[model samples]
Target: MNRKLWAALFLAGLAAPFLIYPVFVMQLLCFALFACAFNLLIGYTGLLSFGHAAFFGGAAYVTGYLVKNAGLTPELGVIVGTLAAGLMGYIFGILTIRRQGIYFAMITLALAQVIYFIALKAPFTGGEDGLQDVPRGMFLGLVDLGHTYHVAGKPLELNLYYFVFIIFCIGFWIIHRAIHSPFGQILKAIRENEPRAISLGYKVERLKLLAFVISASLAGTAGATKSLVFQLASLTDVSWHTSGEVVLMTLLGGLGTVLGPVVGAFTVVALQAELSAFGSWVTVVIGVTFVVCVLSFRRGFVGEVLEKIRTRPPGQND
Candidate 1:
């Protein structure tokens, strides 16, 4: 990633609300962060988790519950939610980290199903209707998140959007640092060859567990922020379908690329919003788009572009 590009993105984020719906952009940022966190495990660590919705939706429920019922501030609620997700990730990792390939994926899926059932039946979760009317609350005992700025005759929740943007940036930076750090390298090594990593005397299981915890916590961050944005926490956040959606975002954007998830999330989210008029047909359109992207850019949109640059002939100009 280039510094110029980073700066450009920062500028774009700042201008996004004025140009587009703030709530919609906030939703995109949240999902993008979630996909990035998911990629950390599956794309970089070679760990395929089928139950990430447990962390994402679980955090949403936690944040919504605390903010609405417990009277916690938004930031505090998000922190608690993130911590809860990390704890869940730790427990799940302990149970499934030893398994390989589909075994690991299936175990995660099974565990996630338990979480979904709990969400469905739990009294505090509001069952099927979900935890509604979750207040945004004040930020740090000041800066009311519900405050809307009237800009050019359009109402924009600038405060909340910036809050979400900052959160997204923090989460993205953490992931970027982790991916470039020695720990990230080890995870990649494990991803490439666990046997070799084990032979090298690395505590592979522990490392993987740590990565899982990190991923889950960040996913929680996304969920928490999303709950604040929507003022609700619902079953959709915890469903298996949501988990699959993140997977598609990661793959469609480019599994291992840093910006791929963001691109993929934006594409998927924008498509869903644009195709909403078609109702159920939206899924069909998205499915077709995914197939086309997969077939045309097998490495993913970012992955393929990067590959082309890497494999380009020397001295060739764009």
Candidate 2:
């Protein structure tokens, strides 16, 4: 059943760009991957991080700088960005892994704020203007990512779109593999009962730190790809509000469920895009939608559907 669903999703993704604006679809893919990375921590490891934008936005700046100023290839830029985010995560994990609950969340948020300020003041980042005009660069020294092709009578950046798609798939696959591995089970055990996990001789701190780094790196991958997609990296990418947005995406999609984040990301992105004409009023609509979802579907959209399936009467095909 899961395989079928994954196959269907892959088909849909392949066809989506032809039907929708390629850039908008690419943006959605990036955010979906971002939300999925966040879920790995909060949903699987039971760690609530309130500053994921540090990894997401920080990696964007790194990738943007490298691809634009240093003239690194797109692939290399993303790799370096991912590694940088992982290193940051390792340092952050060392400092905050000992704390739990709100303390942990607050510590993460504070650290993220520091990154935000640094980006704001750093001359290379263009300050409030952001790192703009970030060239997409060559892909493997073969295809020009900046070049566009006419597809089905529409201008489509097929090269860049495919590049982003490949990155998204790789990142998504890593998260899926992590969630299903023995390490992931231990994470689940830790999430269920940390005391019991420790009693079982599990090095809980090490495991949590590992999880944090993995999540941060994947989030960084999403951000790096996003920078290439939009050709810009700004304060908005690293802001606290972006962090909150990911939280909402994870919750609205069904927290621990594997497909929840993607679904939630789609809904939120679609709403924002469609409601853009409303200007600042868009936030009000999103807030109202979130409240309605919370009230009507406590388990989240996908979570509620899964619950129904689980509780259905045996042999009832209908």
Candidate 3:
């Protein structure tokens, strides 16, 4: 209900690896953070840039390259990816801000298409083969990553789990601050009534640009962390479908709700896990779920449910 509660939940998540399969949960957290970052731009700024996969997947490839070839630590590689995504967002934001409505969305989508092609052709990405064998490395040369071991011949390790959890904490804090800050208030105003905010001297376009950059930077953070966890970065990271997956996440969660995306991410990831036996049918199921969410529950699972609890029909409640 409040930021304090959210902080407590995050601390609890840090201890979650002991209670649950850490790697699976860790993947969920990354996607959750990714969805949250994306929501900042679309939910608050009223801008729908469909090319988010470029930031997420692109960063993954970049981080993988840096860690494998450049001999950089995981943290440094993540920062490099974040900065690259931020720069790309800035350049794209500047160019596309001129077009409003669906044109802006289409422009971003087209640009992201170009990025997908570039990734397809890039040699460092190993062409269709992708970059693999990425070391989890160490956390600032302290923790021992060692090698993943198998218990009874089945594999298990908490290293990647902890790594992803730390990054998720960072992402959560960043989004929390953005939502509670004065800047966030301006963004909300722009979302509700951009013309009025602009008339009041808010520099609407500048605010939008800043939002885009922040969103892209956070998406990049998610991507970079994922690259390390999976020990590989491939074309799948930059694919258009990846972008659509996150959009599904934000919509499934409450759009403006801070923690909703996390819940949505967890549910979706878990569903994917359970449905893995179905092979390609998993995508069809997810697509159906997305459509259902769009048509039946416009406020998203959390947002709508909370609306009822937070509001009462004029009758008193105990």
TM-score of each: 0.98, 0.97, 0.93
Model 2: per-residue Cα lDDT over 171-209, one tens digit each: 999999999999999999999999999999999999999
Candidate 3 clashes: the total is 0
Question: In candidate 2, which residue pairs get closer than 3 Å at backbone N, Cα or C atoms, i.e. clash?
Answer: none
Model 3 CA lDDT for position 181: 98
In angstroms, the error of model 1 at 216 is 0.6
Q: Extract clashing residue pairs from model 3.
A: none
Q: State the lDDT of candidate 3 residue by residue for 1-318, as single tens digits.
A: 566876788688876766667677768887998999999988888888888999998899889899888888888888999999998899889989877879988898888888889898976778787789977787677765545656555565666677677788888889889988999999999999988998999898899999999999999999999888788888888888888788788889878888778777877888899999999999999889888988998988889988898786677776
Tell me the spans in candidate 3 whose CA falls farther than 4 Å from its real position: 1-4, 146-156, 313-318
Instruction: Sort the candidates on lDDT, descending order.
Output: 1, 2, 3
Candidate 1 backbone clash number: 0
Per-residue C-alpha lDDT of model 1 across residues 139-171, encoded as one tens digit per residue:
999989999989878899999999999999999
